[model samples]
Structures are given as C-alpha cells and as structure tokens.
Target: MAFTVKINNLSKELTLFLNWLFSIDIQANMPGKSRTFRCKTVKFWSIWPLPPKVEEVHDVVYLDGIYLARNLCVLICCNDTHVLGWYVCRYEHAKALFNVKTMDQAFIWINELSAWRMTYSDFLREMTVDEFENKCFTHERLLKAESSIWRMIRQQTLFTFLEYIDITVPTTNNRIEGGVNAQLRSMLRAHRGLTLERRLKAVY
Candidate 1:
C-alpha cells in the first residue's frame, strides 16, 4: 500500500508489515557487519511510539533500536556507494565488484555527485551523524530520503536526455507554436483551391 498505492488492494496495516519484514530481511542478509538485533527490531517500530525522553532512557529501553538504525544506514550507504563506484571504476576486475545500482537510475545521483565538487563527507553532513547512525534505522526516515535522492537522480537523467535529443526542454514553447502556425498558413496558401472544411479535415 505504501509503495504501490491502493492499486494492489493491500491495506496500510499490511503495507507497513511488509515494509518491516523487508527491512528485517535486508539486515539479516548483510555480511561482515554487526548489528544489535534489539536495535534492528526496535528500528522497525513506529516512530510515534518513541517518547521525547527517549534520549534519557535510550540505553535502558532502546538498545536494539540503536543497532537497527546503524545497520540499515550501513546498507543504504554501502549500496548507494557501490552503485556509484561501478560507473567510475575502469578496471575490468574492479568493475566486477561494483553493483548494477550504479549503472541505472541511481547512477544519475552518484554520477552527478561525482562530477560536482561536493565530497562524500559533505553529503554525510547533510545526513548528520545522529541521523545516519540512528535516524536511518527507521522505515519512515529512510523512505523519505530514498525518495528525495531518487527524484534528484531522475531529474538529472531527464536533463541529460533532453540535451542528447538536441531539443531544449523550454520553460515555454511559443517559438514552436509560431512555427506550427507558419506551417499551417503556408500549406493553406498552397492549397487555397480547397474548401475551408476540407482544409480543416486534411489538417486533422
């Protein structure tokens, strides 16, 4: 329901459950990484349930929550960086280590960042250590940032696509409109012998 809308006929409850399950599976599969299962499962819990005083008693109640957050963040960052490294690495053997995420939609974000002067540390600052090490553990925050990055990637891809086609994605197309009008006028003069009704039908 969250990703597909209501088209899938899945309820919000079901969607939330599935999303939680997927996160669990993703964390479970990561290797060479350590995550506190308490944090992992707590990371999947509803954000609204977290009281404002969570910071005071966090150690007492949310040990697993902290681990969950850190694990999810590692995966997200690693997966994203892996995708980026693919397009950048030229070595045939090194290229094998890069994943497909860098070759497709997500690559646009990675490539744009690569060309720009912004450092990975700069991007990490936007996430903030607290956000990265903790906030990324939650489903809601993760999905929000994921969507934001994806949109940036998509916009860059469209701009590149327009450039390749040699057609400016104009803010306004008055020039195109005038060109179409000129074509119709010239065509009409050449076929003035035809009735207006026939001209309209032919144009259509």
Candidate 2:
C-alpha cells in the first residue's frame, strides 16, 4: 500500500512537471518550487525534454526561422496549428531547395554570373582609354545582370505554395508567426537565465 501511494505521488509530480514545462502563461503564475512535491523549478528544467517524433507528413506546411542569438536561429515547421519539427542552426538556409535537381543548376548559374561580374570589374580598373570607351556602354548592362541567390530561393518557395493552390493552405505563415513564435519569445524572455541547450530544450 505504501509503495502504491509513492508511485501515484511520483506520477502526479511528473504530470505537473510536464504541464509547467509546456505552459507559457501558467509559468508566470506558478511559484519557483512545487508546493506539494517540494521540488525546485530547476530540478524539472534539468530533465531535458525530447522533441516528439513526427511521422505523418502534412500536405501544406509553413516554415519560419526565429533568432535566439546573434548567430543562432531555430527553423520551425508547422501545419495549421501544431509545430511538426524544428532545427537549430547558426544560419538559415532554403530548405525547399534541398535534394532537388534545379538547386545545382541555380547555384551554377549564380556562380557564373558572379564570376563574370568580378572579371568585368577587374577589366574596368586596368582598361586603356579606347578600351574604357568600348566597355562604357556595358556598365549599365552589368548592373542589370546582378543576381541574388535569395531572390531565386524566394521565387521557388512561392512557386511551391502555388502548386498547392487546390488545397486550403494559407498564403502567409501568420499563424506560426503570431501564435507559436510569439509565445516562444515571451517564454524565453520570462526565463532568460536558461543556457543555450536548455533554451533549445524549452523550445522543443
């Protein structure tokens, strides 16, 4: 009977811990320690929360990145309501372009354009008067030829969403931005003492 009671108490404590961990608004109202279990909030935080395994793929998903620090960012994937997955990295990259054949072609084209721009700039620096006159007409053309990798990636992202037009996917990821990301920022601000690892765990 005593052992059964202990088990029940432990289970209750575990439930409370999980509730505190995930609850943003509740945390603001709770005390630093669990009154019933006599456990400090730090003890609960010490146990790292694992990200839930996501096997089902949503037809329409939203992707966004939120910066935690100067060099650190978290990329989030979500459907209409729930966050499916997240990745922590130093820099943001276009996930839509990964493992596609067109990615290589786009990079190659951008690289060739960049190389040509560099060559043109160097030529202009050492050109003779007659050479300068010949190339002067091309200066405006060179300016117009400038390419941006981000611009290309943005176009691809838009095209992917356009392909899913028959479905009810939102044109913007405002749900994730206003709901999940906003809550996360608020929670982080409340618990500013968390280390990088713990901060990520909190996010997970």
Best by lDDT: 2
- RMSD (CA, Å), candidate 1 to true, equals 27.6
lDDT at residue 108 of model 1 (Cα atoms) = 57
Please, what is the TM-score per model? Answer: 0.17, 0.53
Which ten residues in a row are the worst by lDDT in model 2?
Answer: 136-145
The digit string of per-residue lDDT tens for model 1 on 141-190 reads 53465468568666765234423444333443333234433444555455
Off by over 4 Å in 2: 1-5, 18-43, 95-169
For candidate 2, write residues 35-73 as lDDT tens digits: 543353446656754557998967878788888878889
List the pairs of residues colliding in candidate 2: none
Taking all chains together, the TM-score of candidate 1 against the true structure is 0.17
